[model samples]
Target: MTESGRKLILSYYVSIDGKSVGPTNGMRGVMESIDDEAQEDEYVRQLWEAGAFLMGRASYDAMKGFWPVAEHPSAAPMNAIPKVVFSRTLDSVEEWGASSIASGDLAEEIARLKAEPGKDLFAIAGDSFQRALIAAGVVDEYRLWVLPAAAGTGTALFPEQDGPLRLR
Candidate 1:
């Protein structure tokens, strides 16, 4: 947790082989194998539990086209939750109802957000975005949804560091 007592929860969907994207490298394609409504319901609960959501431009672009008109149970919380898109080139984030763009230093931006008084910040990001956060050591907790399939050779979540990590 940060000094503000707010936790930054980094949530992601990985393959059974620990790949950020499975053989398909697509969310809908590979995640379609999940025939469990219980898992989805739990995810919805988690989304509602967050005070704000964070993402990168790519994640925002992909979601902007879908979540705004989505029919899934998670859509409500997804659309309703305040969002922060961390990007250096995004001109506007107003397309989504409650969103703002953060185009500052990555670690500085994370620190500013973490210092804010609110519920824990939630992030569901693409591999590159997630890896950046991991590399910066800004994430307080990681929530991995291990898919029941192998990735074959998908992108890894954690970026290569100078040395091994002793994560708990």
Candidate 2:
């Protein structure tokens, strides 16, 4: 659930073990197996709702390779919507349309974005980025797409911490 007036929603495609991404074969298999018209429709609908897409440097690198030229239902919104990439290293994001890099403090940047008038900020989950957000306790809502296959070893969605992190 969203709190107050705005929200930061983290979205992810996870393995059965809660790993965001794993071995190439497992990732490929999961992607292929989850194909369905209804699901695709729902996904596109969700994508269209986002006022801006948020991600980290790694995700920008990974996505800048594909989403720019992809021909699919979700491509329209993904390309048209503004994107905010949080990174200290990236200097340019001109390749991807409407994309910008957020180099300020994570908490402060998020606060500013949340204060803006727009739909929820939908995040495309990246391992390190997600871990940082989890540790910082900045993510308001989480949306996980759990796939069937599991990777023997991979990044966990929730990083190790001192106490339990509660969610509804």
Best by TM-score: 1
After superposition, candidate 1 runs with Cα above 4 Å error: 22-27, 159-168
User: Candidate 2's residue-wise lDDT over 64-85, tens digit each?
Assistant: 8788798988889999999999
- Model 1, range 16-75, lDDT digits (tens) per residue? 877776335664476976879999999899999898999999989989989989998889
TM-score of each: 0.90, 0.88
Candidate of highest lDDT? 1
TM-score between model 1 and native: 0.90
Instruction: Give the local distance difference test score of model 1.
Output: 0.85
